[model samples]
Target: MISKKYLIVIVGPTAIGKTSKAIEVAQNYNCEILSCDSRQFYKEMSIGTAVPSKEELSAVKHHFIHNKSIGDKYTVGDFERDAIQKLDLLYATSDFAVMVGGSGLYVEAVLFGMDEFPEIDPSIRVEIQNNYQNLGITYLQENLQKLDADQFEVIEKGNPQRLMRALEVCLQTGKPYSSFLTKNTKKRNFIPIIIGLEADRSLIYERINRRVDIMIEDGLLAEVKSLQNFKEINALQTVGYKELFAFLTDEYSWDFAVETIKRNTRRYAKRQLTWFKKNEYTKWFNYNESSKTIFDYIDSKKTETEI
Candidate 1:
């Protein structure tokens, strides 16, 4: 019966209407939804992360939404284990479940077990952090660029934590961070069918800008302000919160912070698309495509095994 189980993954860039599609698919299959969005895991981040509306959540059972606090250090590996356990329970009674989010790395972890890497001394990470704090991110960025040009080009250089992680790995292993990535796929009980929603780049940019405006209207500034003390948290170092934090520190004008948020969000969406596109298994759909079309595709994939 494990072969009969299907994990429907609804993936796309931010503001691509993945939430709506995920809910619709879960309802059709009479299944629960497991969220893979990294930001939505933190309960403190709701409006900025665009968590599902109460009515939408009440309409269908959603798991992993606001399930962790900002203070919790939840990694993608942790999420993969947690998700598998939850999926096992869901599969006990149903043949299908929906997983949805724009975080491609987290999505990939759930689909294929995370790539294993050499264990490095904690002191290497500490040294990198110390250098980053004293010498600035530029120092870490330059070091990574020299150590592993391939990863430097693709990794999000703006995130110091990610940069430090890559640098420390390279220094400790004396190898490019990219060299550790494994292509071997992990076995899972359920079949994963990835559905990606896409739109014209210009249209996506417009939608992102509009969504940022909506978040501002939804009291994102106040939410960011309340978490000012926690700005050092890795979770808050992200787009909306980072830009707002800059404003709170008198580093930028209010208008400039809002604009920066929109700009950064657009960039993040681009990175998400790049990551998802690498997976050849993902089927693409237009953002406005009807639920009936998606349902038909899902039905086609659902086949009976000869007993």
Candidate 2:
């Protein structure tokens, strides 16, 4: 008989200390951490994306960070496939591996597996992309809402990729994207213990604001300026870059872009909580709590096992 493999997932909103705590747990379990963050994938984006520093990386082995380039195209579907493959190899070495990130969908994509979504037509996507560039996100968002209200409500109307995805589904399947989201969770061979960190809403906002300030101080503007040519890339449309892009284009005063980053990050964290709170599998802990307290809570729920 074969023994089952178990994975520990440390999940939380950004700037909540998931990486440091996850490193501690992984070291204790004698294994590496599997990062689910999408932004941290690009090697060019270190300071802005908060890719682990050399000192931090030297402390514990981490997988999937700085593994891809923003210039290279990758999708959530690709992430799901690649992560499963990586986890298989890691599981062969250790029964328990820590997977940590704030990317809710990417994290869920690996643990439960996504539904079989329909493929989109290339022309339809190109058309939508062209319209987004010409008409703006608000215009595209209006169209998506008219096509699929359910998915539109869930998506960040400002996000081009999400709007494009919803429109792609509607155009290809002639059905609403949300209708297909009935999420027949494809079963996986491993069991995951999910740990979520939270804090007072005000405190979380403060941390996010502080992080944005720190990034600016750490040369995030220079990093974004280097990628100025790639501003239209889907990955560059993310929170940090979008804010800086406004500054680069002279649409915002420097102070305004910095302020928007903090504002948007707070809203992003709120949406993250909304997404994860629905999952009953997650056990929440305060972000500022002692490590011993967190481990005690997690240990009570976890069973000791040997690979």
Candidates in order have lDDT scores of 0.89, 0.83
The residue ranges of model 1 lying beyond 4 angstroms of the native Cα positions read: 1-3, 304-307
Of candidate 2, the 10-residue stretch with the lowest lDDT total is 298-307
For this target, which candidate reaches the highest TM-score against the unseen true structure?
Answer: 1
lDDT of 2 by residue, 141-199 (tens): 88888989856655655578878888888888988887776377877768788899999
Residue pairs of candidate 2 with colliding backbone atoms: none
Error of 1 at 73 (Å): 1.4
User: What global local distance difference test value does model 1 have?
Assistant: 0.89
TM-score of each: 0.94, 0.92
**True-vs-predicted CA distance for residue 267, candidate 2, Å:** 1.3
